[model samples]
Target: MRVAFVSMTTTRHRDTEGNRRLERLAHQLADRGHDVTVFCAAWWDDYRDKRTIEGVTYHGVTVSPAPTSFAARLPVLLARYRPDVIHVRPRPPRAVFAASSGGTLARAPLVLEWYGDEELADSRTVRLLLREATAVVTPSEMVRTQVRERDVADERSHEIPDGIDFSLIEDTEPGEEIEVAFAHPLDEAANLDSLLLALAELRGRDWSVTVVGDGPLRPDYERQAADLRIDDRITFAGECSQQERIAIYRGAHTFVQTAYREYFARELLRALAAGCVGIVEYQAESSAHELIENHRRSFRVTDPQELADAIVESGDLERRTIDEDFARFDHRQILEAYLDLYRDVQESHGVL
Candidate 1:
């Protein structure tokens, strides 16, 4: 199958989860012998043209900060590519409009992929895209519920979570000092303050935390840990390579995430795959709680105290049976599901 992916950005332009997911999807599809072409905006010097990476072709549409110029050129590029299906990550309204129009012009089925509930709030653009889409896919049921509540492609919408490359993670024995792992772009919304406060609650506990990832708020978090007098027990490792991150996850006894709004908990999933106990905060907007709600070695907490308590209790929890918990999110399973969705769309459109 020849598939064309339309997105505002790619991992080449930004190192965001959404961008990385798209890149990985395209690469996986290409590896499976499906011809995949990515149509995305050029945000950097090296991205301002056509390039092939990992067997997939990427066409960078040059634009200024705004997507206006790229949107104007999308239809022309889509017509030239003339793929069997057009998979669009609907972000900016202009990009959606262009992809929808281009798919129509090219006589190809349009699939809309959403990562969160943000697009559901854009009634006009979302309605327009839904009307033009052959199918809609989101990473979680929480976002799907919002899509349904808003009457956006109720019948055609499907929930397909982001997948992890489980092969890259290696299991390791939990380290001494009750090593706890927490990773996030240390932003204001990350709720690291709550995590630090919670850690402080465990005053005499023989646990230490390794904070991974880095952002502008790292210094503030460090200062808060100092104020709590637990700075000695916290290690600000900052950013780490993928291999380093997997090792950290493998060695930790528990992994905690306190973000207020996580669309899909990618890091948490990695932690589980690495054999770490999972403890997630219950945020109304986050889907992290859904992943570990009923699991034996996983927990959901509402407050910092609860989180603290969960961390202390995590050491006693049995090792998680990873197969039962993570089977649905296997990369191979996700790829097959996507292939099936593509075929179904193609058959429905009489293009199979």
Candidate 2:
């Protein structure tokens, strides 16, 4: 497949989840013997219009993150490339509009990845883009619903959660016995207090917790833990690598998801993949609960008391080092899903 990816920013410009996603997909497609090209505002230092890095080719549509100029130039370049599929990010809605024109000229179908964290430049433009896009990929049902609410056809929308490195989970041995595991940036939006209070509820019991990640709220969380007198039982390991996190999750019996807002619970996914009994607290602004919807080994709760109750209930569950069920979330499998979507779109558009 000849694929053209449209993203105004790369990890080089802004290391965001949205940017990293398109970047990874482009590279993966290229490595699979597909002709992949990324049309983005120039991240290259030279005056050249294009550059090849690794197996993927990058074609600069503008010299900077100038939305107007990038949109104006994107269509012609994409048309010239003659892509079979145009994979794009759903933000800066004007750019999606431009990519639509490019997709039209190239006889390609546009697939938009909606992480639900994008900064929609305008409401009208976003609606139009949602209506026109051949496929809108969301990482969670929460996002899929939001897109569909805009009157997009059901078949055109899909829920494809972010993939994880399941190999890491399988390869890394359990670090230590962690009865409870919680991983999230100790930031304002991260509802660490819920987990802390829940742990306080189980203070008299025999259990240990490993809280991964660090942020400005770390000191506050530490102080909160101390105040609750459950500080000794909880360890604030602070921003460990992915391998380290998987090890803890692999050892842990229960993993708590208590963040205020999450488009998708990535840390929870990692824990579940490692066989931790998932316990998610329902938050109005968060889509985290959607992950545990149908799973038998998971619990969806409302408050800290419910969180505590679920933790106690988790003790009865068997501990596992790894869960094979999550193999579908592997990066290789997800890349294949993208290929499948591309093939479907191509066949539908008579571009095969």
Q: Which candidate leads in lDDT? A: 2
lDDT of 2 at 291: 72
* Tens-place lDDT digits, model 1, residues 284-304: 988888778767788888899
| Candidate 2 residue lDDT tens string, 93-159 | 7788999999999888989888887876676777888877889998888888888887778899988
Off by over 4 Å in 2: none
What does the lDDT read for residue 124 in candidate 2? Answer: 72
Per-residue error (Å), model 2, residue 264: 1.8
**lDDT value, residue 95 of candidate 2:** 87
- Candidate 1: C-alpha lDDT: 0.80
Judge candidate 2 against the unseen true structure and give its global Cα lDDT, from 0 to 1.
0.88
List pairs with backbone clashes in candidate 1: none
